[model samples]
Target: MIKRLINLPEKSSFFLFGARQTGKSTLVRENLKNGWYVDLLHSEEYHLYLKAPEQFRRNSVYKIEKEGVTEIVIDEIQRVPALLNEIHSLIADYPGTRFIMTGSSARKLCRGGVNLLGGRAVERRLHPLTYLEQKENFNLETALRFGTLVGCAGKSEIETQETLAAYADTYLREEIQSEGIARNLAGFSRFLDIAAARNGEIVNQTGIGRECGLSCNSVKSYYSILEDTLIGIRIDPYIKSVGKRVSAHPKYYLFDTGIANALQKQLTAGLDPVRRGRLFEQFIVLETYRMISYRRSEAELFYWRTRSGSEVDLLIVKHGTIQAAIEIKSGTSVAQPDCRGLRDFGQNNPDVPLFLVGAIGQPFFLGNVQVLPWERYLENLEQWL
Candidate 1:
């Protein structure tokens, strides 16, 4: 398993929520070393919760307290929602007792909210493998080529891509449909395909809903379902400077590039080099964003598009300051015209770093902003911050 860099506070209890296979369980077990674990995923106690919740509660409290263990991990806590309230009460009364609740969905958890905002459980999101974490396993070239969010690499790119594509389908089957989030399972499956196809692009939910014959509200709710399931990510528009002509819509990104490719059902460029490169660019920006978010860094990922025509692929803001502006070109050839967003953003915030993040020869001066290749883009992220 790839070692997750996002560290949990050793002194305080927090909720670690993420999609299955993102290594939440592995991270906690490996890091905590001594927490008493109740794997709700494999427990008969989970079925008991569905039937007789009180019995499940009785066993948990007795199991933890009787063992004299203060730290506890309840895996797949959403599976046993009623246990949350009692768990909260356990932490509150014991004070010394700490609990870590992990789950993939919030819908069932919300419905089972015996307590809201989890007064005691601090909720934090665990995203898919980031560029930084995967560096130790896959080389920088492989990661950049595949982008982020693929699983099981074989000896060859063909074999690796095949494995990842299969994983994507299995992920949808296991996480989305089987999780029982959307009542219309078939519709949600189609929606996944559409969302994956449109990943890294501005989403028009109302239009998508109309096209899919789902209500706008249903589409919005379904988007939340994806968020809860940890399949999709949305970057809100950066509207801090309203005087500039800015686009009003947010952009959507899938958590994994393999999933995005699987949804589109195409592994390689085959012959269309241009299309493959664009997809590669999208993958890089999204994974870079995930790396920042997973670390609990204070940055919002956004895209800037002017009213007339100019556009920037990524605009990262840190605590109200425009920290970085980036444009993505998949190939080596880049011109001054391509640096429009960086120049424009620099005109407003002169200190913020700017870059064309793709296969652009080297990191050099493009009017004060840096220009670097995609292979080295992630490494430069820390420097920007």
Candidate 2:
């Protein structure tokens, strides 16, 4: 089994949230082997808890008092948010017990106004497999093409495509439609296609709404649904004044490239140069996101762009200071012209380090900008900041 980068607290009760199939259950089961495991997805357990939330408390108490159980694992905690109150009380009653709650979506818990344990539980997220976790078996081309989801690992090309396609369908049926997150499934489906097509570009909600026959506010809500479900993340534009007109819109990236491709019905086709480039940039941004999340860094990610078309792909900001300005490229070779965005960004943020990351084999310097291979950059991402 591939080891995930997230380090769960040993003593503290915590909530693990991730999109489905990201391996939250597997990770928790592997680490907390002696815990009392409750699978909420099991219809019997779900209906029982849905009928009597106190039964969860009763059973938990019995296990703790008579069975000598010190750890309890509740899978898909969001399926029955009422259990949280019971869990909260249990935590207060039994200080020795550790509650490991896992959820595929936080929409119900957040919107339903359920008890969140009063800060008694720390929260951690699990993302799709990262290169660091895959190590020797990692393939850049495969990752960029099929994505790094755990389900895609070690599978045949056709099988991987099938997995991604099924994932998209499952997400729509279970997370969106069944959960009633989107009232109009057809409109939301249309919006998803447009969103996947415009993956890395600045979000134009109005334009997307027009195309999908949805209001701008509806589009925003749909985007929130995606975020709450851990299906994607939004990268806001860097807003620090740099004597240039900057775009205010944010860009949304699907959690996995394969999911994006599957949503767009491009999984079986060969990715053209333009599509490949976008996927490459998305891959690097995702890696940066995973690394920052796994390391629990205080840094936040943003993209720098001006109305004049000069743009830097990513910026690492920490404590109100720009740590690094990075431009992602899909090319194997870099030239002076490719550093234009970095140069433009450096003129205003001179103190911040500049980097141009791409498919190059070695690291080199193009003026003040450090050109690095994508892998090398991710391996030593902390040093750059």
Candidate 3:
């Protein structure tokens, strides 16, 4: 089993949220041993909880008092939000018990204004596998092509492609349609393709709405659905004025590259140099995002873009300070021109460390900006913060 980086609280209740197939269930099963498991995906358990949320409290109390159960895991807790009320009371009543709540979508819980245990539980997120977790088995090409989802690991090329396609469908059917997050499936599906195609580009809701035949408001709602369901993330443009006219729009990225390809209907196609470059940038951005999350750091990610088209791929920020300014390149070797954005960024924020990460085989430098292989940057990612 691959070891995930997320460490659950030893004795406190917490919510584990992640996109499907990211291995939340497996991680919980492996690390959280001897716990009372409740699978809400099971039809019977779902119906029982749906009919009588109070019964969950009664049963949990019995297990805690009679069967000496200290840990109770409720998988896919969003399926029955009512149970949260019961869990809330149980938590107050039994301080010794730990409730592990896992869910793939936070849309229902947040939108319904459901009881969130009154801040009784902390929140943790699980992301698609990172290169650090894969280690020796990590393949840059495969990750850029098939992504780092847990189910894609160790699978053949064809199997991985199939898994990604199915994953896309599963999100559409189970998460979007079933949850009623999108009232018009056809329009939302079109938006998804357009969104996937523009994965790392600055988001223009109006432009996307025109392309997908959706209203601008509808497009924004669709993006919100993706974020709430853990299907994608938005990296806002860095607002700090570094002597340039900064763009205000944010960029949206799917949780996994393979899923992005699948949504764009390019899963089986060969990745050309241009396509590979975009995916490579996406891969690096995602890796950095995942590492920051796993470390539970205060760092926030943003992209820097000027009106003249100069752009820095990522900026790591913490507590109103710029931690690192990163420029991603897909080429094997970096040239001075490739570090243009970093140089421009450094004109004002020279104190902030600058990095140019790409497919290079060795670490080198172009003046003050450090150029590193993607792997090396990820391995020592924590130091930058």
For all the candidates, what are their Cα RMSDs to the real structure?
Answer: 3.3, 2.0, 2.1
lDDT by residue (tens digit), candidate 1, 112-146: 44564356667777766675776667564455344
Instruction: Report lDDT per candidate.
Output: 0.70, 0.89, 0.89
Tens digit per residue, CA lDDT, model 3, 91-126: 999999889999999889989999999999999999
For residue 39, model 1's alpha carbon misses the true position, in angstroms, by 1.9
Q: Write the per-residue lDDT of candidate 2 for residues 1-385, one digit (tens) a residue.
A: 8878898999999999999888898899999856799999999999999999999999999999999999999999999999999999999999999999999998988888999999999999999998888878888888878898876778899999998898887776445887778888888888888899999899988999999999999999998898999888999988866333243678999998889888888888886889989999999999999888888888889998888999999999988888899999999899999999999999988899999999999999988999999889988997644
lDDT of 2: 0.89
Task: Please count the clashing residue pairs in each candidate, in the order shown.
Answer: 1, 0, 0
**Top lDDT hit:** 2
* Model 3 residue 356 lDDT score: 95
The best candidate by TM-score is 2
Cα shift from native, residue 203, model 1 (Å): 1.7
Give residue 383's error in model 2 in angstroms: 2.4
Q: What is the TM-score of each candidate against the true structure?
A: 0.86, 0.97, 0.96
Error of 2 at 234 (Å): 0.7
Better of 1 and 2 by TM-score: 2
